[model samples]
Target: MELRVGTLNLASGRDGGGRSVDAAGLRAALADVDADVLAVQEVDVGQPRSHGVDQPAEVAAALGASDWRFAAAVTGTPDPFRSWTPVDPPVLRASWETLTGPHYGIALVSRLPVRRWSVLPLGAGRAKLPLQAPDPRTGETRWWWFPDEPRLAIAAELEHATVVSTHLSFAPHTALRQLTRLRRWCARLPGPVVLAGDLNLVGPVPARVFGAPRLVSEPSYPAPGPRVQFDHLLGRVAASRPEVRRLTIGDHRLVTVSVHPG
Candidate 1:
């Protein structure tokens, strides 16, 4: 069976007119790539940033997927910003307690038949160390250190193989820790496996550091600019070189991997 995967960073709901408004470019981008299984990051379920649109569901529907699942990395409290960023229309906005604040999360949608689904939420926080590396060619400091919640990976038992998707932490150290943890998780799974998401390592690390064979990495972030591949897709099954494509939808660019198992 062929497995097609995609990853996108849906800008926060704060920018979307507080409702489900078709993001002009985004809608077209999705139509262009037409992935069978999509893993999206920075999707908001209930926030004005995305105009309170259920981004995951909307995208799934747009892509003609029959099933979809979402896992929140950060579940906003009902009044998280009440004491912090209070609004001017306090009394009016207070009437609807549930309609306040944006809830950020990640999601996986698929057209392939799924037998089971599971999620692992990587803790949210900053890296403990400062990673400072200078570009060899430009002699410029590439600040690779930044704190972000631990990545959340999704696992699914597909009809022919197991599929996994995750967004890695920004900090190199955090990503290292996450990679080690991912290896452990992969060891326990049975049968051929397909792993995809923002692995955060752009260049030669996929085969060197991770030690996985038959892997493909593609640039999927900061669309239409200097390409720095932050997204990736890997598989355990031996096969031909997987095809990689970049999809820029809305304001985010997604990477899609098409893999063939041996």
Candidate 2:
């Protein structure tokens, strides 16, 4: 059987143009992906800024995916130097206590049946760097001091394989640590496993660190004109070349790969 999977960074519920994410656009974008499983990053859950909408749930619903999990990295609006508390397990797959407060993190949604679910916390790093992004004053690209946030990875054990997704720290040194830790976790899973997301490590570095072949090698950030392969899908499985898609809503372009199971 062939399984299609993709990674999408919601960019915190908005487009590169800063418009709030909506179901219609989500549906259209997901239609293009037609993925059976999608790993989402920068998701907002029950947040006032996003009108309290459950972003991961909304995306899942849009894709008609019945299986989904959102691992909260922090509660309330995110701050540079640690201003939010981390929620524990049972806090997700998210709907349980989402109404209790707001949350920001990553998610995994699957149209396929999921036999198990898991989460991992990659502690926040103490490095801040100026990264390339749109300049608020000029509406052009410029390097701005970006702060790293607490990162989280979510995984789903489907009948055939286990897949993981996460958004790593922008700080290179810290990202390396998280990747190493995640690799150890993957080693214990089933025969074949795949990992996907905005790893923050560019090019062959992620594949090298992950000890897996990268399925996609397209630049996915700065959606306007991508120039780096920050988004990726890497693993030891048969997969078609990844398709980098431009979604109507999101700062990062969606990257999809078709997996052919043996």
Candidate 3:
């Protein structure tokens, strides 16, 4: 069997202006790539910044995918500055009517049907990191300690293999711990497995921790001028050795890996 897997961070389905995505443009970009499965991170759901759009559904619809699943890392109303600075309004608090609907997280979309799915939440604990934020009294970008948010890994079981998608912590030590936990989790799944996502760690760190081989080694961050390879595709099955290529998709570099199984 042959499978093409792709991974990218959607950055909340926008081109960085908090403006709603151009559906036509997204559809065109996805159509240009040939992938059986796609793993996405930083997807938004019913959030006001994204114009209350369901990004996973939109991307799946754009690609004409048969199955897709979204796992929310943060379910409450988003604290805009707590995570990162937003392009538009910095805050959209959970109010009387909209308290429980808005969310942000990751997703997996597949052309092939999914037999089963699972989610694994990973993080050491909430910590804080210095992020540039607008001052409450005066609108000035100042370094503020933002809480390091927890993350989740979503997996889908297809006819041929299992695909796991995750976004790890930006902190190196924290990310290493999450990667270790992910490896242990993947060990129990059946058949060939491919782990794909933006790990936030560079070089051979992921391969070393996951005990898997990387499919490609191409820079895939800060799209305009990629300096590091954060997005990756790693395989655990001995029978599968995939070939990967990078594609420029909007603000992100989409990684596509072609797997030929024995």
Highest TM-score: give the candidate number.
Answer: 2
Ranking by TM-score: 2, 3, 1
Model 2, 3-106: lDDT tens digits are: 89899888765665675546565555566468899999988777654556778878888888977888888776543313556665435654333455777789
| 2 versus 3: better TM-score goes to | 2
Candidate 2, number of clashes: 0
TM-score of every candidate relative to the true structure? 0.73, 0.88, 0.81
Off by over 4 Å in 2: 23-25, 78-82, 88-90, 94-97, 129-146
lDDT of 3 by residue, 1-262 (tens): 7888889888765454323455565565566666788988887777665556677777887777888887766764434446532222112221112324767778888888888888887853466778654332233346777666667788888887899999998788898899999999999886688999999889787998999888877787767777788888888654333443433343457877777644
Off by over 4 Å in 3: 16-25, 83-100, 131-145, 237-251
| TM-score, cand. 1 vs. native | 0.73
lDDT of 3 at 37: 88
Best by lDDT: 2
Q: Name the candidate, 1 or 3, with the larger TM-score value.
A: 3
**Cα-based lDDT at residue 234, candidate 3:** 88
Provide the lDDT at 199 for model 1.
68
Clashes of each: 10, 0, 0
lDDT, candidate 2, at 116: 83
Pairs clashing within candidate 3 = none
